[model samples]
Target chain A: MPAIEVEGLTVRYGDLVAVDRLDLRAEAGRILALLGPNGAGKTSTVETLEGYRRRAGGKVAVLGLDPARDHAALTRRVGVMLQRGGVYPGMGPAEALSLWAAFYPRPLDPAGLLERVGLSAVTRTPWRRLSGGEQQRLSLALALVGRPEVVFLDEPTAGVDVKGRQVIRSVIAELRDEGVCVVLTTHQLEEVERLADRVVIVDRGRVVADGTPAELVTRGAGRSIRFGAPAGIDVAGLAARLGAPVNEVDPGEYEVGAAASPATVAALTAWLAERDLPLADLRAGRERLEDVFLRLTATGGAGDGGQR
Target chain B: MSSSPAASARQPGATPPSAARQLTRALAAQTAAEARLTLRRGESVLLTLAIPVGLLVFFSVVHVLPLPAGVRRPVQFLAPGILALAVMSTAMVSLGIATGFERQYLVLKRLGSTPLGRPTLLAAKTLAVLAVEVLQVAVLSGVALALGWRPGGDPAAALGAVLLATAAFSGIGLTMAGTLRAEVTLAAANGLYLILLLVGGMVFPLSHLPGALADVARALPSAALSGALHASLTGGGPGGGVESWAVLAGWAVLAPVVAAFTFRWE
Candidate 1:
């Protein structure tokens, strides 16, 4: 059995349907990154699998135990790192870590874990006083303290500095080597590319794509041109002129996730030149995960563009 | 698939202690941590310790308020009411408002995910409240003693009244914190403190009010607790021991049950 499995999961808050029949599976010894735009129901899906949410309908099992029905048993094996502010403001990381460690039968050493997370210097610093990077590291430390088989991290590197990112990345890579199942949700595609073994993109409460990072990168494998321009550019007009689908993957960032021959590049540049638009960063390569992501979920999604 | 080779090698859940043992260990550890957190906070110390003592000392010496009929010393009547106020402050005003903010700040929400489940968390918070209540009672009684106020009546009953009143006020506090927004709970807790002090007869005598209002005031959780404590300490008076204990017990049970049903994690 997969370490984490959700079959036809459905979650609703009052009248609004947050998650609708979503299914996912993550294997042991690998990191699966769940990605989505804001309000795309990623939190609802992750929280339901963690047993914090009561699903409207569907079956979710972590380690073969029903998350909602067998929550108490599941919690023993599952560790959750909330998106923000779980530690008490008044408590220092040292005291807090030791207290949380007492919950598990045999937890990792709090002091060693602190050092591993690069938090030895600020052991006595209260949670509120710690920088955002330090706090995220502490949260990661707490999540790992239990030595849990399955760990759910919400935006582990959202506001982290480069050193903090390196620390988190190394710890996560180590978890996979130890055969732990790591599930995370984040917006940083670079982190996903560097850390995630499998990538699952969720949009409108469903999985739009699920595969290994390499598989996803090459799934739509082809020569493509990516560039940065002012946001709200007429993607439809550009696609018609260049005969390649153009999407604003992020605000003011565009991706052309398709065949981009010499003609297409000249056409794109000419189109910009006619409007006196200075082309920002430009790249010609195989479809990256970001291009695939934007292709799968753009301003409208699949079947939402002009040519190619 | 079974767990990873490395994970399975650690003898996961193999030699763990019994469930009861783990829970007991968690409870003790959490309580100690909570106590430290509670005491270190300036606001917590001020609410749970300083203000109650300040009210008791100020009222006993100032002699500004009129005494109830048949009451000889100001400390005799004011001591019981002020003690009840202390419990209310710790249970509802101090702890309850903090818990409401805890919900907003993700303290309670994050803790909920751990093996130290909601019941254990609630128990830890309650024990912390009781610890503060114990300190408040000791300091208040000491102040009352030095004020030349003779405390007579049922010592055992006074202790019982304190415990029951703590339960009742904590139930009220949790109810507000779990359901309402933190800011609203903060405002409401302080507002309720003042309301109870005036109307619950903790400061003013119940008899001073109109008959219907006095009857209602006597039945509130605050009034019931103070009345029961006063009756116990004074050896017998209009504080009305037996019925007040029953009223407090009722609140102690009903309010928490309601809170258990209504509370939202975040």
Candidate 2:
């Protein structure tokens, strides 16, 4: 069975529906990235799945048990890095980890947990004394200390630097390798691209799109050919000669679309050769994931403005 | 892997006194952790211990209020009342105010999500308040003994009186903290502490007041606590003033039940 199954889930805060008819399933060893902008209910969805908040409608089964009904049991098997959770100011990182680990039936070694989160050196430092990155690492250590079967991380790399982000990414990968399901919510698209096995893009409290990264990228349409033209070459003539629509993006840059990327590149190169014009730069590729994301999310536009 | 038979049987309603003991131990651990956090906070320490001690010293030495006949030595009469006030200040005011803030911060919510249940969390917080009470009593008792105040009866009864008082006030405190906004709870708790210290007979004898305030004093939790303790310290029989005990019992039962019903975890 899947580790988490959320079917027709709806959560409302008063009149505002935070999560609307959401359907999702995650298996044992894959990372599912819940990507959304602020106020899109990503945090609310995760909180409901973790049994921290009650769902107003539909069903949520986590690890084969209802999260809201079987909270204590679910807590034993799942680890949560609560959004903006604060530890006691006076407690040292080691003491806090040890204390939290003691609450679980079977927990990872405190020392090893610290070391894995890169917090071993400052284990003795009090929580208030730790830097922002260190605190984030400590939070990660606490979430992993229970040796949980599934982990829910919300904005886990919010304040971390590049190195710290990589450390968290690697730890998440390691968790996946060990057959631990990870549900990560993040605004950083690059991190999602690198780490997520599947993507769930939420907008205005609904899942607008859900698939693999590459799959979502090509959902928009065909590829485009972008190149820098020679100064005096008839950029408009080249467009007419190649029988392809063209537009100058800048003084000497132009772009056009093609059904086949290789054919487009060859046609552009030969067209330049016939005209004895130097093609300063040329490339053809599918629509970028970011481009697809913007198009799908933006309110005012449709499909790259018809290749212009 | 399956759980041990004993562990499986220990589920909610089954066998094993050991399971109950383990639950109690878990509760105690949670309580200790909370107390440790409270003690580490400088402001909480000041509010819990320092403010009461300061108030006690200030009211005992100052002769601002009038005294009655046969109540010679205002210090002696004020001493028991101040002791009760200390309990109220820590167990009721400080505890209530802190819990309100904790609820606002979602600290209590995090704790509630643990293997520990809501009832266990309340029990643990009450137990932690008791631990702080013991320390408060030791300090106040030491200070009182040094100040030439002598107990007229068995010391054990006095200790029992203080413990009962702590329980009664803690219940009221937790209830208010759980139900009210942090800002409102803070103001109400501190305001009530001052009102009780003066009019509820914590620093002044209720007998010294005229009809109206005296009647109100008799019903206040601080009055029951201070009067009961005063009666015990002065060798008075517990039989005549079962009213105080009854008042305390009413609060101890009602406040916790109400708190449990109304408490908001987030």
- RMSD (Å) per prediction: 5.7, 5.8
- Cand. 2 TM to true fold: 0.86
| Alpha carbon lDDT at A216, candidate 2 | 76
Separate DockQ for every predicted complex: 0.37, 0.21
Worst 10 residues of 2 chain A by lDDT: A299-308
Candidate 2's displacement at residue A7, Å, is 1.9
Worst 10 residues of 1 chain B by lDDT: B1-10
Candidates in order, interface RMSD in Å: 4.7, 8.2
lDDT of 2 by residue, A123-147 (tens): 8898778887888888887777767
